[model samples]
Target: MIFSRERPFLLVGAGKMGGAMLSGWMAQGIDAAAIVVQDPAPSPEMAALLSRHGIRHVTEVPQGLTAGVVLLAIKPQLMDVVLPGLKPAVGDETLVLSVAAGTPVARFEAAFGPVPIVRAMPNTPAMVGRGITALFPTTRVSAAQRDTVDRLLSAIGTVEWLDSEAQIDLVTAVSGSGPAYVFLLAECLAEAGRKAGLPADLAARLAEATVSGAGELMHRSSEPPATLRRNVTSPNGTTAAALTVLMAEDGLQPLMDAAVAAAARRARELAG
Candidate 1:
């Protein structure tokens, strides 16, 4: 499918992730009339917001409603039930993008019959337009279609394209499930602060701000993360003291390696 100002986009689900994409598109001044949202039970906030924007919302896929780009944002487990119903709305010319985890490109190809399929693994931060999405497209997808998907995802956050679908499983283990790891860090840091005698609220606030600020710095800085980390560490200082333990043979390195391995295993299992 060729994406142009004239092409209408269909978002098959309007949950948190889907809503975020719609909001990003609207915020970027994309035409509201060019988008169609389909959800059986869209949130009241979403319903009201879509209504205010004058965008189309349907509880069911309307007959003969052809969309140039169709976003499959529904749960992977529900793809079988959803795709069959959506087949009519999806034309041969439609470019299908699936954000559902573990549902491979072959599944969509089987259902949609060789329609250009781009599978993406987007993190939770996309809800705030600061996420990163890793995309993997089938060989059948045209360069134009790939560019269109890339642009659409880039609106929400950074987009990274992988040369192989095998990398998507690793992407799922990293960025797809990475947010929770960062949140866990915040949790641990907050607990440690409280143990060091800070008030619970202050500890939580400090932890949140520190993590967020560090992440923003890493994003804006030209230096690699290791450089930023080394810059903060001073010989015999508190930061170094902490690093001594964290960088130990059985510390964060081994722990993270094990964690990512487990996550990758789970992703593979889910795909199977």
Candidate 2:
């Protein structure tokens, strides 16, 4: 309801995340005609989707038009060049929703001159519509525009709104980069199993299944992760033994704390 079919939804990129969002919008019954995508070289799959939806796809920005929502889904490095071309299409009423990581709201205002902006950090899982995004909106954003952003992002996954833009960098580290960390955990788990004498293929499968199942349980359960861990551990049992090493003084906790901090530091650096 927040999104308007009357006004054009100008999308600057049709890459993975952008394409995923479009897929969601279509599935939710958005009129394909209302969307216009601009990408120099879209993937075959993306091209097919656009064709199927009958959405306009252009390699260049059309001259002198007002877009209701200018969604920027391109790389942050390209913003310097891309924003200039897009500026003409951004009217005072345009709500700019950027999904580019490490890009701040001021960057857009500096280019487009104080249009309503919402900066978001979304992870790779958005391809599967299971991603979690963190959003930071400028003070200029109206309540109705915020609702529009909420509905638009809901297409990808759950959304968390932050009170301050500075918090977005932390979010960039957490949910935005968190999926790779989980994948790395699965890799290490598989390696550990292989080292413990299981066959390589079997070890990988076991590790993958365990991680995925545990993640599902965490999602389904109302209890905290710590409680879930304790629930699985018995006196001097295998799970407890593993937890003893994992929960040691110099263990997973300290390591993970350092990892998250390092990621946050890098996020701030990228923003700069």
Candidate 3:
């Protein structure tokens, strides 16, 4: 739903992810003049975009500008300082959506006085408008408000609604931190190729293209990832030879499992 002037969209933090989302929204016909961006240091790209789109980018939360949906995309550690300024504009009917990692709904409620809140975890991919956000809305959020939040978040990428807030930590470990895992895989592949006598640039390009191409194929295919793997692996083939080590008991699976568990634990800890 396009926001009306009666309830403008107030974006807190116009950094990469937030800037990407705003770009998407503008592409989809949202009025930039009706939106306000609060960011201390917007990138050059973001500053140019705000100027082009006629959106307001202010360092302080503007007085008397009511927000229909106040989307918080700031750092979790800075919430105490950042959120207090936002309190005055939060009306009874206003909805709050947070994309700050490891922040819980209770913290928002305590700060904002029982406003409807939706906590979300979005990855860095949102900067490219290909991210997936996992959301958990509190009971105070109505169906209509949820739909609005969905439409707003859809600007970045797909949105997955969760049944419980506890699952957000797992989501944080998985999708929230998943990009780094994929990036590391590509880095390792490139290094291995270089060690195997490929030129540095060639090895890096090959690894990057292979990983990205495989990811694109997986996205377009209806078959499961496991099935895709099997299709690529022939009995006694080079792919199968590589898979043998990868599928071993003490291989990538166990390592990834431990990594995810540790991430989830840290996510929960950060919530405190």
Predicted model with the maximum lDDT: 3
Candidate 3 clashes between residue pairs 3 or more apart in a chain or in different chains: none
Steric clash count of candidate 2: 0
RMSD of every prediction: 1.6, 1.4, 1.2
Write the number of the candidate with greater lDDT, choosing between 1 and 3. Answer: 3
By TM-score, who's the top model here? 3
Cα lDDT over the full model 3: 0.89
How do all models score by TM-score? 0.95, 0.96, 0.97
**Would you list the C-alpha lDDT of every candidate in the order shown?**
0.87, 0.87, 0.89
Q: Write the per-residue lDDT of candidate 1 for residues 1-272, one digit (tens) a residue.
A: 25433556889999988888888888888788888888999999889879989998997887877778989888877887899988887778788988888888888888989788889999889888899999998887888888888888888999999998889889988998999999999999999999999999999999999999999999899999999999999989999999999999999989899898999998888778
Instruction: Return the TM-score for candidate 3, rounded to 2 decimals.
Output: 0.97
Q: How many steric overlaps are in each model, in order?
A: 0, 0, 0
lDDT for 147 (candidate 2): 90
Segments in model 3 whose C-alpha atoms lie over 4 Å from true places: none
Q: Give the clash count for model 1.
A: 0
How much is 182 displaced in model 3, in angstroms? Answer: 0.5
| lDDT per residue (tens digit) for residues 199-264 in model 3 | 999999999999999998998999999999999999999999999999999989999999999999
Those runs of model 2 whose alpha carbons end farther than 4 Å from true positions after fitting are 1-6
